[model samples]
Structures are given as structure tokens and as C-alpha cells.
Target: MKPRLPQLDRPVRMPSRSRILAAVIMLAVILGPFVGHLLGAGHGQAATPVEPLPLDSLLRQAEDQSPQVLRQLLLALVMSLCCTAIHLAVTVLVVVSYESHSLMAWASRTPLGRITLIAGTAMVTFLAMFVEILSWAALYLQQGAILPVEEALYFSSVTFASLGYGDITLDLPFRLLASLEALVGILMAGWSTALLVAVIQKCLALRFHRTDHGSDPTTATNP
Candidate 1:
């Protein structure tokens, strides 16, 4: 009984090494685009500046030849991959930690702690996705094609979620990149939700055990 109870009451071990690795991965992902852009900009191809496309035309072009237009597309792809990797790593962290925390709290634990952590992590992930979307919108807008912040955000959310409402259709070339964002977003959201639920259930079970489970079933039994 003592051993089992103590085991259940132990705190989860944080993976310091994994977290450090995650940080490195995240940094690399973030830098991939800028690095790609620099490298792509200086490639051996002979370059001749040409008349810039008109706003609408450029926007269309950017949308269509996204790969050709921004050297960052490749970088963005790599960045997205990094984000995915970090996302997965963080997820594993939360799961392992939550389990450990639950085991430690044992009979006295409640779902509140786990809930808070899950919610916090999810919120951060949500923000990260939005930020990535905003970066793309800003890049395009810099090229003279403008979408309202609200509209861009909406499209971004939908894209990230992979809902593909089709209400605000991006140009053909842009669509491919957008799809990638959507896929990443969907996977991240799903993973976050699963971890959150698991933590919540564990927390709730502890609460139940301490409350209902500890109660005398016959306390209210008629004498």
C-alpha cells in the first residue's frame, strides 16, 4: 500500500535534454527561412532586374509562383517542419509531466493543475500558428498585395485548421503553401486536444477518488 501510494504520488520528471533539443530545433526552424532566402538570393544564376509587376499582377504572381517569388517558401517549409517537431516534443513533455504530477498528488490531486497547464500550452500553440500565418500575410503585403488583418487572420485560422471553407480563396500557387500550414495546424490542434483531455481525465479521477471514493457510501443510509 505504501509503495503503490507513493508511486502514484510522485511528481513527473521533466525532460531537460529533450527541452534543450526542442529549443535548438525551434531556433533552427525559425532561422531556416531567412537562411534560405539569403542563400537563394545569391545563387549562381545570372540575375537581371525587370519591371516590377503591378499590384494586382504581382499579388497574382506571388500567389501563383510562390516558390519562384519568395526564396523563403523553401525556408518556410523547413520552418514548418521544425515547428511540427517542436510541437510533438512539447506534447510529449506535457504528457510525461502530467502523468508524473498526477502520480505524485495521488489521493489529494485535482484536475485544476493539469487543466491549467494544458490550457496554457494550447493557447501558446494557437498563438504560434497565428503568428506563422501573419508572417506570410505580411510578406505578401510587403510585395504590395494587401489583405485586411482580420481577413488574413480568418483565412489563416481556417487554413491552419484545414477547414478550407473556401470563402477566401488564395491564388493557385499560394494554395499549396496554405495547405501545408493547414495540415500542420490541424495536427497540432488535435495533438494538443488529446493531451489536454488526458490530463483533465487524470486530474478529475484524482478528485473523484478523494471525494466520492473516500466518502462513506452509507453515510446517508437511513438508520
Candidate 2:
């Protein structure tokens, strides 16, 4: 038989001012894309024709014409990143306010719930980064030829990490976007690691307490 959990020990959280603030910000980020898409659709009706995106068209543009394709691509990427950052910022604010043992409490309530929640958060971040990468690749390919899918993923990751090995050079504006993504990745990664460690420590402390009490229930009661 599966063992029953000891009762959860953390104090309750209530609806409060900070939660409302976070809710509104998160709602805005979650809603922003659809709103932007709607606006884009409306604007596209009146806008001039955009450049084509096939391999031939891109190469033709990149080799002889201006870097407009690359610039446009990077604009989409920047938008994707800004949205991702806002979403993550919302997550951070909401997460930081959570009381001790909360994720563990949720985990205790249901198998894989916490895992799924974390996975969803990761997916959102990666998808946003993917949009950024695609923007760069879209511009690059328009300028030149299509990169192999594997090559594109590799290039995107390396560029985002700012470890540009000089193997995949880009037009000037795209080069700037690569630099910005790299800087963002480094700073955000450090911040994420720190926050993750703090959260894990809090969870681990609760687990340690549970273990101590398991050794003797009265030990917890006495302490």
C-alpha cells in the first residue's frame, strides 16, 4: 500500500494585495500575444506587402539588397523575448510569495503535479526563445539559404548563449540581436539558478522536518 502523507505543516496563504498585482501582470502577459496578433491582423490589411520568405527570395535579398529582412526577423524575436521575460517575471513574483512547503504540499496532494507545473513553465520559456531564434533564422535565410534544422537549433543556442564560434556570421543588426540574447541568457540563467536553489532549500527544510518527526511523532510535538 502507498504510505499516507503526514499532515501538511505550512500556514495557509490568503488572497491579498500582492497576489492581485501578480495576477494582473500575468494576465496581461498571457493575453498580450493574442491581442498583438489581432492588432497585427488589423494592421496587415492596410500595410504594404512584406518581403517573401522562401529560400531563394531570402538569399537574393541577403546577397545584394539591404538587411531589412534580417531586421524585421529580429524585431519579432525581440518581441518574443520581451513577452517571455514578462511572463517569467510574473512567475517569479507569484512564486516568491508562496509560503514554505507549498510546492511540496501540492506534490503531496497529487503525483507529478509539481513536475507538470514546472514542465509547463520551462516550455513557455523555451518556446519564447524559439520564437527569437526563428526570427534570426528567418532573417538569415532570407538573406542567404535555408540552414538545416539541426544547424539552425545549434546556431540559435550558441548565439543565445553568446558563444558565437564565428562559424555562423550574420548581417550587422542580427549580430546585435545575438549579442543581446546572449547577455539576457547569462543574466537570467544566473537569476533562475539562484531562485531555484532558494526554493529547493525551503522544500528540503520541510522534508528534513518531516523525517525528524517520522523518527518519533512526539519529537515534533515536543519541539
Candidate 3:
């Protein structure tokens, strides 16, 4: 005869810290461009038919415009903070719902279910990054830095990926904003990678736990 382990009435909880950080990075990636747009709006239009300058010249130009650069940086910081806070709230709610439902445990019970869960998580994170890129694209269109929405989005995607294809280019002022967008993209992408890894690891741990207990005769009993 074997003793049965007690059934857990309470569901296991996912760690919230990593998810919260991922959400914050996602939000910052979107709002950083918006902040740049708002702050630079009053600065007037960037010179069209932009003259290509050497890297040193561009760096010098940015350095000379200390006040404007400072304002843009301040605005970006404020927006990032606000967006990060909002993301944290949303993440908390989502995590609470997921934990209460015992979704992870159910997913762990089956190989197909685990795969689906991991795939879904990856998709969600990818979508978040895509949406953030779209926001920057929209801002580019509004600011006249890019022509059509399609082109703007294409450029945004390229910049977000840090591909720097160099086909489409922005003027000096907006170039700074573009650079900022690229930075946000890098951070968000890294965060998403971390999130996906965490999710997969958690799922695998659950699966292994189930396997261990199922294999143990002491943990099971005849009805």
C-alpha cells in the first residue's frame, strides 16, 4: 500500500518580478519616441534635404544644442517612468489572474499543452515589441520625418531591429529621436528574450515536478 500526497487546493504562482520588468521595458520602448516627439515639436521643423555630415560633425552639433538635448532627455525620462508604472500595474493584474486559474499546472500536465503555452507567451512578447515599434512609426509620420505610414513603419521596424540599413534617413534633430528609438528597441527585445526564457524554464520545472511525483509510488494511491 502507498500513501497519497495531499492534493493542493491552491495553485502555484509565477514569479512577478521578471514579468514586471519585461512589461516596463515594453512600455518604455513605445513611449520614449512619443516623448521625443512632444518635446521636439516646439523646436520647429528639421531642415529638409538634409546634408550628410561626418559622424564627428553630427556629434559636435548634438553637443552644441545642450538645452534642447536636455529637454528631450528629461521628457523621455518622464515618459519612461510613467509608462513603466502603468505596465507594472497591468502585469500584476495579469499575473494574479493567471495564478488563480492554475493555468501553468494544467499546461504542465501535457506536452502539447506546454508547447502551446510557450508559443503563446512568445507571440505575446513579440506583439508587444511590434506595437512599440508602430508607435514610433506613427510619431515619425506625424513629425514629417517620414512620408507615409507604411514607410514610417518600415523604417521603424528596421531601426528597432538596429539593422541600420541606411536606406531611409532622418535629419539631425529627428536622428537623435531615431537613435533613442533604437535604444528602446534593444532593451525591450532583450527583456522579451529574458521573459520567454523564464516562461519556458517555469513550464519545464512544472513538468519535471509532475514527472517526479507521478513516478513516486508513495505519492499515488489506489481509489
Candidate 4:
């Protein structure tokens, strides 16, 4: 007799309601400040003026202060890695939860359902990115690199998006961190895009498979 192989169709474990509630609370904590910052934008006391410096001047300063730049770069890299890991975790959690609950099977049955799935995934991706930006903003605020909560959030958002609107700028010593954030943002954006594509492909495949086999595409044996 041949040895039994592990089953590929083993049931996925859905997260409990308590786990889902915890995840919701965590998202609220991460995104609350951003919502508050937007709502209270004009009501708050004026942020102290931060003069923007020319890029060339900032570069020269960084060159002259190699040790400080190196330290800041290392810190930025560490933060970027942390943010990436957090983003990946969020994406995996969402995908797994959806799959475990057979949401993919339900969504694959209709065009509208597929659209909703894609839209929901996009929103989650945006939220994850915002959470990362807020983390960097919190770091900037804590370090006294940007004093006002609103300004820190704004600077971090623009920096992370690589917008560089020139309306807000970090000091020379901390400027390298902004560059790192921009790089991370680009990578995360690409990652999110790829995730969306993969999700769409899965949905399409499941839809076709269910149509042909007359079986629930997401069905699995219970453990």
C-alpha cells in the first residue's frame, strides 16, 4: 500500500469573530489620527513655519555630515522593513480570511461580486499604506523632526507618495529618511497592484472551474 499524502483541499480555518473584532480595532487605532487630522485641519493652532531648503544645499549638508546621514539611513531602512512586514501581514490576513470564509467562491459567481471584491481589496491596500505612513509620521513627531501632529502626517503622506510638493520639507539631517519612505511607498504600491492582479486571476479561475465542474470552487474537507 502507498503512504497517504497530505490533502490539498483541507478546510481553511476562518478567523473567529473576536479575532475579526481585534483586527478592526487595530485598524481604527492606526487610522484614527489621520481622520482626526483631516477633520480638525483648520481648527488647530497654526503650525510653526518650516522653511524649505534647496535640494542641492541639503545634499551638500548630508555630504558634510556623513555619520549622521548614515545613522539616519540605517534607521530609515529598519523602519521601511518593519512597515513592509506589517503591510505583508495585513494583505495575507485579508486574503486568508476571505478564502477561509469561501468569499472567493461567492464572489466568483457574479460580475458584481467580483467588482466588489476588487474594490474592497483596493480599499484595504490603501488603508494598509495609510497605516504605514502614519507610523512614519509618529516616528517623525516623536523625534521632534516634525512638531505638529497634522504637519507630521501631511509630510509623511507626501513623502511616502513621492509627491514632494515642496510645501513641506524635512530638515537636512532627516531628509534621507523621506527618500527611503518614497522608495518603500513605490515598492508597496507595486506589491498591492500585483496582489490585485492575482486576486482577479484567482476569481476568474474559480468562476470557470465552478461552471465546468458544478462544484464549489472553494469547498474543502473539514479537519
TM-score of each: 0.47, 0.43, 0.61, 0.63
Index of the highest-TM-score prediction: 4
Q: For residues 44-82, what per-residue lDDT tens digits would candidate 2 score against the true structure?
A: 976976665899887786686456546645665765566
lDDT winner: 4
> What is the overall TM-score of model 2 with all chains considered together?
0.43
Per-residue lDDT tens digits for candidate 4, residues 1-223, read: 9999798787889899999999999999999999999868745544655588999999998688998878888888888888889778878876785656467667757878878877888888889989999999998988789999999999999988888798988887788888888898888888889988877776677667767887766673220
Estimate the TM-score for candidate 3: 0.61
- Give the Cα lDDT of each candidate: 0.63, 0.59, 0.71, 0.82
Q: In candidate 1, what are the lDDT values of residues 1-223, reduced to their tens digit?
A: 5555445566898879989999999999999999998887877333745676789997886688665536546745775776676666776766565445333353244455546655766676566656656665664455333357777767766777778788887764465567667776777678667766765665555555557776422232211
Which residue segments of model 3 deviate by more than 4 Å? 1-64, 78-94, 215-223
Q: For each candidate, how many residue pairs have backbone atoms clashing (under 3 Å)?
A: 5, 2, 0, 0
RMSD of each: 23.2, 23.6, 25.6, 26.9
- Name the runs in model 4 displaced over 4 angstroms: 1-64, 98-101, 211-214, 219-223
Candidate 3 lDDT score at position 61 = 84
Clashing pairs in 1: 8-103, 9-103, 9-104, 10-104, 12-100
